[model samples]
Target: MKTPLTLLGLVLLTAASCSHESLTRPAPPPGDSAERGRELARRLIIVDGHIDVPYRLQEKLSPEGEPTEDISQRTAGGDFDYPRAVEGGLDVPFMSIYIPAELQKTAGASKALADSLIDMVEKLARTSPDKFALARSVDEARRNTSEGKVSFAMGIENGSALEDSVANVAHFQKRGVRYITLTHSADNLLGDSSYAEGAHRWNGLSPLGKQVVAEMNRVGIMVDVSHLSDATIRQVLETSQQPVIASHSSCRHFTPGFERNLSDELIRAIAAKGGVVMISFGSGFLLQAAQDHEKRLREEAMAFIQQQGLTRESPEVRTFIENWLREHPFPRARVEDVADHIDHVVKLVGIDHVGLGSDFDGVGPTLPVGLEDVSRYPNLFRVLLERGYGEAELEKLASGNVFRVWRQVEATARP
Candidate 1:
């Protein structure tokens, strides 16, 4: 048996070998061309690690909770819709089944909500069979792509949904959950979250959290480290047998002191583990200025709530919030900013360790200008092309890297 140090050495060696392979690989048949980039986007299997469509849909629906929004068509408001996804050449998108941190306190609420979200995804595919298909594996994604359908992959955005039971991991896997984010806005039984203030229950991961990681590996579920604290991310990198993912994280080097984004060292560590850091497109994640502005807004909002002795649930407070948001709009990040994170990852690691994980619906209207919706993926591809990315490199950025990790995780799982 290899010692932890020996295992880490092997992991680093594997990552270096993969990195070398990507660099030495032959170029595409054609040169780096915009037209070729567009063509390749249409042909390649692009997979986004996180898109909170179900939660967004729930928000957009009527109070009665009926299916008011038809995402199967070209929807007007949100970032993702079927027609837009097809236009953007997005073949596979992991629908983030996000469970809020507060739900962690309840015994079975998170699990129930997760189940409902999965049911919602299944319903979307069932109702839009011509346009959508549920993809449980890379092969299924390929099959659905060949059939001219957009493949939907599910990722549980909070490990709290597992309810401290490792058995629930397999249960969720059976329901098509491909990955699990260790924590959300707050610390859970699993681990500490970057967003949780003064909450460092588990400096990294709790005892059960370690067991959950192993169970996930054994069940072929990718461990997502997004929203985890630096300590938790490092712990996950050390514990997981297969490569894990930062489902929707950005380079913290860009937004210094922002714990939600992965620091340069953590990014390098993840790459050493042979995992890909999927760059998030949220403006807060992309730009320091945006991050600062968001922090100010939250502070002001909290102050206002206290000054007026208003509760968040109060109608007056809601109105105040609405008016305040209207008064101070967030600065818009550009497509170039999103590309910058990708470039940072490439420079720090390599193209083999970077991919897309746009927090589309999850980011509200804070997305960059050109990448406001699913249809804008081609704009990113064009930017990459202009930045000297060839078809091979672009393909790796698009989905090849993530597919490689997914396949490796699947291979390591108990059959």
Candidate 2:
């Protein structure tokens, strides 16, 4: 019944009314801390400095180089998988190419194992392009993150892979290894390890270690001081032109006398050099009680192994340890304890020097409560959020700190 002009007027009014309604609509209520934390995790580019995925896969591989467990889908064992990583909002997890310390005793074994692990990681990305991508640089990581894919950034856990050659530093850098932990479990030719008992071999960085550090700097590999002895760490701080990282270490304040964890002085030294100390998530690394419990269990288990004339790798020893653990369960560290480590580092060196390295898949059953796997990173964020960490601070802790160091290392490298 309306005229054409009237109809046109009605249409325009209705359109304006709809737009007004949309503009005036109230915002949805904010989610709870946990939900908000999860949202923030998904929105941020979370980079875990060390994750032992390659070594984990290597353990499960058949003799023919085929992986027994499919990581693209959720697997029964290990801390990493595509689904869990996506759920955890993990963007860049440095795949640890962990060469065993025993290989250091062998001439060519270390390099061979290192190459095989690198091949495995490359294959993971090649076979699962949609789920994973190899991130050779920070820019590539960011790009992969934007595309909703997990970036497989790599770090060699044991510098033994260098095989007594400084040139091997450049070789690893070319192979997409971004960082190298100078030693692990035992003193290699590079330096003394924190876990290696008795007399110190190198006292600090060996002559070859100094050259390796320099070569690492020249080739753009970030030096990792995770398992290095205290003296080695000190010398590495003095030697490297680039900032170093403790890829998977926690504070020694919580677990005193634990040389594996960085001391306050060392942490400060690392910070002064513009480095990051990526806090590990292992319960043993976080709590004195947990560390003591683990030490006791290890001693008892070893005694049992010796009594039975069995090696540590024997199935009987594994079962004995399993039963012992069931009888005397480990004192698990909570998510709050992890936050305390972060707080300790922040108070000591500020938030810019601390980040997560979550030695996941490598820590076995020792991961803290609420951070049992990669998918629980949001739990740590939630605890931090409750402790008054803002988005900017959380973002820096998530990846900004490490990315800054990484970028600086890359910039310092020469052609």
User: 43-108, model 2: which lDDT tens digit per residue?
Assistant: 999999989888777777788879999999998888899999999999999999988776777899
Report RMSD (Å) for each prediction in the order shown: 8.4, 16.3
User: If scored against the real structure, what TM-score would every candidate get?
Assistant: 0.90, 0.90
Clash-forming residue pairs, model 1: none
Model 2 pairs in collision: none
Cα error, candidate 1, residue 351 (Å): 0.7
Assess candidate 2 and give its lDDT: 0.84
lDDT per residue for candidate 1 within 262-350, as digits (tens), equals 99899899999999999888777777776566556556666776898976555665566557667776567778788888888888898
